[model samples]
Target: MDLIPPPAADDAAARAEVADRADAYAAAPLLNCLLREVAEPLPRADGSGDRRVYRLPGGRPLRVRGQRRPAEPEVFTAGNWQRIGHTELVKLVVEELVRHTGLSNHELPAEMIDSRDAVAALLTARARATPPEDPYLRSEQSLLTGHPHHPAPKARGGGPVAGWLPYAPEAHARFPLALLGLREDAVVEEGDTSALDTLGEAPPGYRLLPAHPWQLDLAARDLAPAFADGRLVRLGTTDFPAWPTAAIRTLYAPGRDLFLKFSLDVRITNDIRRLWRHDLLKLRRTDSAALSAFAAIDGPAAWLSDTGYRTADFAFEELAVLVRDGLRDRVLPGATPLLAAGLVEGFDGSPLDHAPDPAAWWEAYLAQVVPPALAAFADHGVVLEAHLQNTLVAVDAGGTPVQALFRDAEGVKLLPEVSRAAGWERLVYCLVVNHLTEVAAVLADRHPGLDPWPAVRRALSRHDLPEVAALLTAPTLPGKTNLLLRWTGADGADARYLPLPNPLVET
Candidate 1:
């Protein structure tokens, strides 16, 4: 059967018509800001009328249409409009655009669409009732008392001194650098520590600098640079204080990089419970076991072994080591295509909605990268959290998914009741279907040759029957499954309670 084509291009008059529609829809001040910042008028694909497309600077493209609601002044009421200023609302507009444009969620930046500068300024003004800097920093001993209030003091290296504020003079006596990601091996002289040594050495043609002692860990290791200037720069703390609870982001380097995340709420201990379940039921039962049984497996299925769990700690260290070793031995030797394409950068470069060809990228991910990952997981009884955020795609020079890196402990799953099955399904749905499908749609929109189902089939083919059966028959696991179920319902209701058979037939 012939494939369904994208919208046909409209003429100039049609473009004007589309522009008028956008103008009408952009009547709200917040939407107007979005129009100015990210929206653009375009010709209709069907050649019937005009259309408006929204895009971020150097990011993905999206089509904007007026929401079909009866005109009501209350829709733009002051309180309602104020609510629209939140980051979540901005993300909603962005997500809608992604759906309309058929781009993957990855191509879209985290900021997606944002309000006008005026709105932002006004909001900032309103929130200025308190100082931007924490006021409690002044009382030294008082701040230390608050340490017990923190959730992960041990993770942050807090002992009996846990509650003490490292910034305070009293706390400084013991753990002066406690707030930073400084290396234990680092030597200190005249109050300055040695510069951090980056992994992979600085790539050719770029200047290198010692990373700040605080930035010496795995995430920083991936993006280490060589600086010719020989200047000592502070790489800031790799942790951020959380809201309400005193939990901290384990790998947050201000102005640098952020890694796999989990909620600070103490109630949820199984942050990566879903990943473990998926790996156990899907990968271990399928490809890993099947390949082992047949003696046809290639390379080490690290996901199936204990080594895989250890390797997860330092930013895909196992894969990075494999690649580095390959290069050292002249095996898989060459500069990574992502680096060559200028896609590899420090934390400053990460934005979800910023790919040039998001559709092409998604296609490559599903076709080439995902299948291998599924096969690897199946062999090792490893469940991977291949969510949009955890998985980093490095495009080739042509902006294709040449390299895929999955990070974040939350995204890594081990099996055997590590977490609840319901929780596991929720995580799977969020990471696999909810997140990746969004990106896949975008890819399909831009490149018709890239089909998502075919990619899924290819992944399944690489594994065995029982593993696929587990995934296909698994109940809706908790986490973000409720959100997906809302969108999947008949008029958006929970249908998981209703009877439904497994969608996939056993091999």
Candidate 2:
């Protein structure tokens, strides 16, 4: 019998580092939830003058101090204040939420602990891991504190660390895909899935389809029936490996110039990372809408179209695989495209890390990213989910942004299908609040006292959407209440946002 060894857990230095990293990793989302959903400001309580203190819903005063991310948590107890680690903070949050909302969630608190433990495993694995050579791949795998506002961004559906670390992108892990064949009569597909057919050869009577090996393992029990009945046959694995990008379910096969998105049952951040049937059915239409919208726009922005998909008829959503346009085909000539999320996360050799001129670089980035997203919403009625992960900025040799390419058709919303008003709101949240606000903050962080907001205001002012003028002057912007949403056990896709102080405002 063979066994898969657990992630490294013995080094003192690594253990100390994991403890530190785990605190930061786990605290961000918990803090976000606290501040966004429950915490109320109690001015000047920390005695540091500049530190902000907030009162938890349960009436405990918590003081925090840090930079560029979540601050260290210090709770008021026993007269003098004492610091609480991530685990205690989770407990504090659970207690506060129970008192605040009169709801005791058994599942969310467990997921919170799982998220923290997963971070420990990741930090341990990463301390001994080699980063990807390709800078783009490195950036795509750079999100350690993912979805800064979600309560459990790194939780692997409560699975053990060993079960997930083998495929974690943060650990710079890469592995070959598990290829399968669906019996010809049981195959269900739409659009250009020819890219998938080329991954490997199936038997004469079957069609080739590539899958993320992790997902195959997750769905193994459900798929056993088909495997036994000969409706599905194993065709071994890919000869070469595919790199898992920041979006854990999506893999980039550089050699083949292809991307394959699979059905992942784990809950990462907001939703269970599954390729749902409804999204798959409407994908071609939504992607076509985005493709046409980008084609009509005048700038260097490109849409990495989700060309097609393939799945088994018997288990459509569970066995789904989406084929998307890869970087080599869509990127501009002589330019290297980098993930925007990675830009914010910061990786080795990141163009943002060693930027020559911060303001100029930010301006160029805005030029490439802003106009097309606004235009897509206004002119073509295609509301792009232009959040950081879905957007890529390809820069020139000097690392000046020249092109912006967007992907993920499953997230794209069409015109009349969603009212123009609703589409604009979604676009504002994604493009402005979630995407640009983050990039601006990172750039500003790199260069102290350099306000990136004016440039953002300028870039947004140039857009003629009726919403633009009001957006530029709006006092409050919608901040998604991910913590409260999860605590209340609401459907992940049902986004409920509370008004946040709009950073774009000149205040």
Candidate 3:
């Protein structure tokens, strides 16, 4: 497949346009973090222009143009309002965070800047590239502003643009897999990895191991010795191309009907996108629990099992690639599965964006998404990481959501493994705070005065869990502190949350 179309070939005007958009796209999430985590909202004195004012940690008043996805940031400095670009915004954020948390993070500031530059590259590449014809692939690739509240969400490990753009989902990239023949002795695998053998042929006494090209590039040096010693042999790329999904490391092969996830060794948002040894060892148990939980529930909801993984023993974590169940049998027949995040981010054909009856559409959405998540928690003690990226909403012919399919066992947390209190908090943060809140805001914004939260309340109320009543009447909900978490250098999995006003409660 042709990748990225060579970045518009030195068009100065095009470059400027790309830069301007990248700035706006990049500023929204950083501003959200600064506003939510550190900056205090100041009451409107002269309520006008849909603009809200805020006080930064340094006591300087900041004003933004919009509420959801705030833009055109301005700071009150030198006795006048000064418009700040993404660069100035990053500097202002760093300064305020230093004052607010009394901690300095040089790396995060660089990452914030890198994230913006990465956006510029993506915008440039996307302009020259043709989007996928498949609406599912289009939804999978259309997350320009990911993780709405994450600081530096687009940072590609501060690597050169050329290094990552070819494989970037945002760039609508599709490429064939680089097949490797692993010596029988060097093969380290677990669970059902049978799907891998169908990718290509391997010589006698060797197993076929399909490798992600980007990962191979990232780990070439370390594996050089093994290749030289004949423990690994290159067998060339796959005939059919695999499209990279929203998760950069995971690629979907439509022809083969399989999903492959690899360790990227890049810091995307929070963690280093690596399939850690610890997580790999416990994959079967966690995935089995999720499978059992979903099987017990009688609904259109499904769990895309992380079937198994394969890797070289010498480069276990570095070359580890996970096999995930595809959308063939999991999704409801005749329904198209779209990434939930793409709905919030606004894709080309998102059902959420063009719903004729917004109210009914929202209720259908709530019905499909809410039940399975709550059932898993209440009935099976399985807390799914039902965040936007992990959830897929399959829409019927009328573009109404009919089913919800969840993935990523690596993020799943079992009940007995963690305290109920801790599991509940994590669930609330992932499901209610991260996922529902953003989708609700978008639905409300698109169709004004059509409240989405009431349907959400009704959906939660239908579930008879003890937590449901308390959740409905709760004063606040737990919101993950992504900015603070990164600032304090906390582990990505070690989530810390702050209380945000609960929208589930009836006013």
**lDDT per residue, candidate 1, 160-262, as tens digits?**
1222122112121111111222222221211111122222133333222222122233234443431122222234422332111112222122122211111
Regions of candidate 3 where Cα sits further than 4 Å from its true position: 1-10, 46-48
- Model 3 TM-score on a 0 to 1 scale: 0.98
RMSD of each: 18.7, 1.9, 1.3
Q: Judged by TM-score relative to the true structure, which candidate is superior, 2 or 3?
A: 3
Ranking by lDDT: 3, 2, 1
Clashing pairs for model 3 are none
Lowest lDDT block of 10, candidate 3? 1-10
lDDT by residue for model 2 (1-507), tens: 012344456656756876788888889768877887788877676364556688887788888775447678888888877888888888898899899889889999899999988887777777667788888898899999888778888888988776788888877888899999899999999999998878888998999978787888899999999999999999999998898999998999889988889999898887899999999999989999999999999978999989888999998988999999988868989998899989988888888866789999999999999999989988999999999999999989998999999999999999899999888888888988788888887877778879999999999899776799998889988888888898898998787878878887887
TM-score of 2: 0.97
What's model 3's overall lDDT? 0.91
TM-score winner, 1 or 2: 2
Off by over 4 Å in 1: 1-363, 419-427, 447-451, 467-507
| Clash count, one per candidate | 41, 0, 0
Q: Rate the local accuracy (lDDT) of all candidates.
A: 0.30, 0.86, 0.91
Q: Please report how far candidate 2 places residue 420 from its true position, in Å.
A: 1.6
TM-score of each: 0.36, 0.97, 0.98
Error of 1 at 369 (Å): 3.5
Query: In candidate 1, what residue range of length 10 has the lowest lDDT sum?
Result: 318-327
